[model samples]
Target: MQTIYIDADACPVKIEAERVATRLGVRMVLVSNGGIRPSDNPLVESVYVASGPDEADKYIAEACGPGDVVVTGDIPLAAKCVAAGAKVVKHNGEELHERNIGNVLATRDLMQDLRSADPFRQGGGRPFSKTDRSRFSEVLDRLVRQAKR
Candidate 1:
């Protein structure tokens, strides 16, 4: 059966993903290092990993396989999930598959390099908007439906 694995640290669409998973009858796993409330819903499973960098990512990457869907903004985790044959979606609703994972990983590495080389060059991405939430919901719904079949 297909499952939805969410890298839940700082994830904005947790509720949305849960709703979709519940509606679609697919299991949704929210992996975090703690601080997230465990859901009462039977369809949702909240996994708390040890408090350390990438612990949740490691869990998701190792558990997910073909027909599974992963939701994360971490480019490296997304690349790993994609390589493991799972479908990956960014927080902003972008899909990262085998065809584009390399480019996305490269761009992320380039940005990290630029940031480290220039400490003063510090600026984060735009704030999450309602439109992004809507897009994510739609895309996630579509992906889950596809995974079910």
Candidate 2:
């Protein structure tokens, strides 16, 4: 069975992902440390892992496999899920797979190194916008439909 695994910590599109999963009749697992309200929908499952960095990521990477769709912004976690044959998508609608995971990881590492090299460098991405939300919904819907096949 195809499932949607969401790395829910700091995720901006939880409700959108849930809507897509529910509409597609796919099981959606929200992994986090805490602070997430449990969903009443049977198709949605809220999984709270131990408190720590990457605990939720670890769970998501280990649990997701082929035929699963993983939603995460952590590049390393996305790489792992892609390696495990799961389709990975970022909150902004970027799809990570075999074709580009290497470059994505390398870019992420380079950015981290550059940030570490400069103490004054600001660390943050652009704010989430309405366009991003729309793109995420469309991409998620498409991925779920593809996974169902």
Candidate 3:
């Protein structure tokens, strides 16, 4: 059976992911420490892991497999899921695949190093917009349909 595993911490599209999962009849598990509210949807399950730094990440990675769809922005977790044969997608609708996971992981490491080296570097991404939400819905719809096959 296929499932959708969501790294719910700081994820902007949890509701959207639930909608797609519910519509597709796929089981969706939301893994987090304790911040996420439980979902009322039958197809959705909210999993609260221990309050360790990567407990949720470890749980999601261990549960995800060949027929799973993982939603997360954590590049390392995405890389691990991709290695485990699951299809991974970012909240902004970017699909992380085998073809590009390596480069993405490397760049993530590089960026982390740069950030740690510079104490004055303090910036974040643009606000998540309505257009991004729409795009994520479209990509998730397509991915769920493909996973169902």
Top lDDT hit? 2
Root-mean-square deviation per candidate: 0.8, 0.8, 1.1
**Model 3 segments beyond 4 Å from truth?**
none
If scored against the real structure, what TM-score would every candidate get? 0.97, 0.97, 0.95
Q: What lDDT does each candidate get?
A: 0.92, 0.93, 0.90
The residue-by-residue lDDT of candidate 2 on 49-130, one tens digit each, is 9999899999999999998999999999999999999999999999899999999999999999999999888668898899
Q: Per-residue error at 114 for model 2, in Å? A: 0.4
Model 1 bad stretches (over 4 Å) = none
At residue 54, what lDDT does model 2 achieve? 95
Candidate 3: Cα lDDT at 23: 81
On TM-score, the stronger of 1 and 3 is: 1
Clashes of 1: 0
